[model samples]
Target: MDNQRSLWAAWAERLRQRFSFILQGQCALCDRPTSQVFCQDCTRRLQACRVQSSVLQIAGLPPLYSWGYYEGALKQSLARLKYGGRPQVAEPLGQWLAQVWLDSGLLERGLVVVPIPLHGDRQQQRGYNQAELIARSFCEVTGMPLRARGLIRTQPTTAQYGLLRLERYQNLSNVFQVGAALQKSPNLKDIVLVDDIFTTGATLKSATETLQQSGFRVVALFTAALSERQIA
Candidate 1:
């Protein structure tokens, strides 16, 4: 039974990979043919908006780094990934983020990458965590170890969109807890929190505080895009 299960799993993975390759050949922004998620024209235009400073400060949280302002082609691509069931969009977006991390001279040899976790019920509904998909791609390009099980969302919260800033913070308060697997490993030091977008810093701050309370040092927050309101 185990051997049969393994065979089935391998076959499933191959199918997933084949589908991803076909998806990759089409530009995510304009639907033009290209070898990456974004075609050459879209890539050039998107790269023009790269954030000048690689690091940003959020009130009472670790320094955050983002690839670019969440607008134009980048914004549409993220929306597709997060809401349109386009998991393949994370690949090129995550590669760009990983390149930014490397360019910032923050690529430590042993730093662990942790994706912001979704509540169990929410993840089941979405079929996958968008942050995890991006983090997996980031790890693949950077060769960094991903520690997704380090943190788990303990409670489901209402969506932060359209909520007041204070409400957003309150919504996420005390919602994250260190996972059992990570609690068993006491040697974890430096960590990078990966997320698809940085809107109000509520989620990252809550997760960072949870890890810190557990004696883990969250070195930084790395995200694909920074919301326009936050950038303003």
Candidate 2:
């Protein structure tokens, strides 16, 4: 029964993907008519923000790969994706991230993509988790397995926008719990966390520690954009 259910779920996902393109209307950034999430001109401008190099060795975090700096078109697109009811925006962004990862020669077997999850209440309010949406498209392009529910946000925290660096860390402490799927298979390792943005790194740090403590090896973090402060 479990195997049958898995097959059904996979079929349903494929069916959804098959028709997802038919729903596209206007570009998320500009209101241009487009079958894609972004228009050609907007996509070109967004690509201009891409970081030439793929990997950045931050002081204490895992190897990070961000598609672009969080500024200009990239920033605006992310804002629309996260706050403006534009879930379709993730499709292209995730594809872009996957392309960069492939081009960087970082492709490897057994690395599971785990999207940073939102708390249940927050996800219910938003109707979707942007990170998970991005990770789904990323896996579609990369063929890497996606553990969409590998981690659960057990506690709801306030928005981290105005908080200081230390405060942000405090906000997310002990917030992530290993989901049941990951708990059932203790051998699953080699996690690559995906998120829409890497800001002060507080959120990723807490999540990485949680996964590490749970015995999973977090190899890298893949994000669509890096905060301007991170670029400096």
**What are the RMSDs of all candidates, in order?**
10.1, 11.7
lDDT of each: 0.86, 0.90
Mind giving the per-residue lDDT tens digits that candidate 1 earns over 1-232?
Answer: 9999999999999999888777667777778777776789988878876887768887798889999888887888888887877788888778988998888887677688899999999888878899999999999998988887789998999999899989999999999998875777677677899999999898999999999998889988999999877764
Best by lDDT: 2
How much is 1 displaced in model 1, in angstroms? 60
lDDT of 2 by residue, 54-144 (tens): 6788887899999999999999998898899999999999999999789878787878899999999989888999999999999999998
Off by more than 4 A, model 2: 1-24
Work out the TM-score per prediction.
0.84, 0.87
Candidate 1 ranges with C-alpha deviation above 4 Å:
1-25
